[model samples]
Target: MILDKEVQRKLKIEPIEGSYNSYAVQEREKKDWRGNIYLACVAAILAISFFT
Candidate 1:
């Protein structure tokens, strides 16, 4: 699974063989940033809903 691949890559217990490692790194970082943005949007929506 890609999740396992990502976790293994970050933990560095075993190095990934090749291109898969770079792809995992990109995916992880992208998701991390996206999560921050998503949370901010959700919080804003909730706050606006509350105010209305």
Candidate 2:
């Protein structure tokens, strides 16, 4: 499920018809600032574990 942005851009890739638009994705995360903070905490833990 890896959408390689570099390859896609170079190849002029386009999404399928009737797909969920980018706006929908933005709206879904619009009110999820708290979730983002939690993710940042988890990422910090993982980074610390890796570096330490």
Candidate 3:
């Protein structure tokens, strides 16, 4: 599935609720980081497939 760049951009602009507490934010950030890494890896794999 293709991702819309604008949608991702808009999501980034919004403030997350319940993320102010240190522990909550830390856990949330870890999840977000993991998601970002996974998405990036998927994109990279797709790009590689197109070239090969």
TM-scores, all candidates, are: 0.40, 0.39, 0.40
Best by TM-score: 1
Q: Candidate 1's residue-wise lDDT over 1-52, tens digit each?
A: 5665544333324445774554323323324587889999999999999999
Q: List the residue pairs that clash in candidate 3.
A: none
lDDT of 2 by residue, 1-32 (tens): 66765432223345556877522222122365
Candidate 3 residues lying further than 4 Å off, grouped into runs, are 1-31
Supply the TM-score for candidate 3: 0.40
Q: What is each predicted model's overall lDDT from 0 to 1?
A: 0.63, 0.63, 0.61
